[model samples]
Target chain A: MAETSRDAKRARTAQLILEAAREEFATRGFDGATIRGIAAAAAVDPSLVIQHYGSKAALFAVAVQLPSNNADVAADHLLEVLAVRLGELPPETRALVRSMLTVPEAEASMRQFLDERVENLAGSFDGDDAKLQALLAVSGILGLTITQHFLKLRAFDDVSSESLLEAAGGWLAPAKGDT
Target chain B: MAETSRDAKRARTAQLILEAAREEFATRGFDGATIRGIAAAAAVDPSLVIQHYGSKAALFAVAVQLPSNNADVAADHLLEVLAVRLGELPPETRALVRSMLTVPEAEASMRQFLDERVENLAGSFDGDDAKLQALLAVSGILGLTITQHFLKLRAFDDVSSESLLEAAGGWLAPAKGDT
Candidate 1:
């Protein structure tokens, strides 16, 4: 009974650490962030972080949460959700956009995430140009996200999420000529 | 005669510094890099960095030149150049592609440049959907670039520069319909 309770507590503690780590890493970046900082943000003991995640790098890998077995599904869902959320953002979201554009920590985390995606795709695809194709797809999605969400360029920044998603879905889908 | 030579030397020194700064920032990122490091790489005295560029931030602004002016012309020319370059890269260029995609410094610098371009466009185009449209265009171009150059995705990575340019050029041109 005691062991069961202890395991539950450990799981709960790990969850808290993860949430805190995501926010910290998103704000401070991998190099700038510390284990102690993440623990403090979670209101847990610093040792708990090391005990739970092994190291700062390991903690980061977990916090970033790279796309998993369902890459295509996740990518599609991300595009759809982003298109909607971006369209619905209150006027106040300008501040959020501004933060995303100017913040180094946010930029770093984003880069790390995209790089991993590209690397994973490169490994799975087999062809002379397989790696480049993977890179392009990753770059394209990232480029779109940055331009629409952060820079808020004209036409793109003002359109409904539905419209953006429609366009992105078309581009992302396999075209007849592609094969 | 001596004054003219001194002026020429100063100009040469400034150019060298700027070039060195670009490479360093592209490789090490803004936070990890230092003025002394840039100077050493440039083979100039550290004080000359301050004398020529004033500060690290100032140097970065100048070194990482954004595509702010003549968007249409720059976009067109960039596409052409990239297409040609893509066709010319040796098989070994795969490694370069990997580096660009995986490196945080490269990723941040690329995003920073794109964000600036999108923001500049947003200021010019005003309407309900103008911002969104501008953002989409920027993202599209960036996405295409990453796809073709880094990921080496099929069809795109293997095609000749002119062929790729032809496809991209059409995309960049004003859309005729919703499709």
Candidate 2:
């Protein structure tokens, strides 16, 4: 019973530290963030952070959750959902999008994610033309995400995701000149 | 004659400062960059940076040249030109593209450039749609640059820019459902 209680306590402490670390890393970047700052934010001693995560770099690797395969599926459905959700998002969400574009940690995560996608998924293409098509498809989705969500350019700021997706679906279709 | 020599000397100093600043800002970011470090890289006294640019921020704003309009053409043409230029670039140009995308100073320059495009040139579309189109265009360009050049995702690393441009032009054209 005592062991169970201790494990639970450890879990809660780790969760708190992870959340704090994510916010700090996102805002200050990998180079700028300090483990001590993360500990203070998590309401724990610096030693506790080392105990929980092993090291600052390890904590960061854990904090920025790399989007899983689930995220890829989510990305495929992004335009449809984004259009619906745009009207409902609070101002903070917009700010978050802006930060993701401007911040180094967010940018690095995005690059890493895309690199993985290209390596793993782009191989499905059969021929040179087919590969080019696959590349364009990926480029279109990535472009839409960065422009509409991250850069928050005035052009896309007010446009619904539905309209954009409808256009993308047509553009990304598997036909010559369809784009 | 002495004024010409002074002017020439100042030009060389400013160029050195700018080059050093770009390298520093690219690696360390704006907040992390210091005039002292820039001076050290340029082999000049710290006071020279202040004398030339007034402040670190001011120096940065100047060193990072934001994209600008030539005042003689439409945004569409600008996009086309960008597409062509990007397509024409050699594979070795990936380093430059990566620097543009990942560097904090370069990202800011890109934002400023896009903001100007939306404000000055994205006037063709009606109401909010203009902004949406502008955002989409920028997103498309950025996505292509990152995927093809910076990240160099497999097949894209070796593909010629002309082929990529041909693909993009098709994607950027008006949708059948739209018009």
**Residue by residue across B59-120, what tens digits does model 1's lDDT show?**
87666544434556454444443333355433212222222232344345555555555555
lDDT of 1 by residue, A20-135 (tens): 88777655555657899989999999999999999987776666644434446444544543343354422212222222222343344444545555556555666654545454
Which whole-number lDDT from 0 to 100 does residue A125 have in model 1? 62
Q: Write the per-residue lDDT of candidate 2 for residues A45-151, one digit (tens) a residue.
A: 99999999999867866766554444344324434332322444222223223333335555555555555554444454445665666666666666665555444
In candidate 1, which residue ranges exceed 4 Å CA deviation?
Answer: A70-75, A78-139, A174-179, B70-75, B78-134, B147-163, B174-179
**Lowest summed lDDT over 10 consecutive residues: which window, candidate 1 chain B?**
B91-100
| Highest-scoring model, DockQ | 2
Residue A32 local lDDT, model 1: 55
Report residue B64 deviation for candidate 1 (angstroms): 1.1
TM-score of each: 0.68, 0.74
**In model 2 chain A, which range of ten residues has the least summed lDDT?**
A89-98
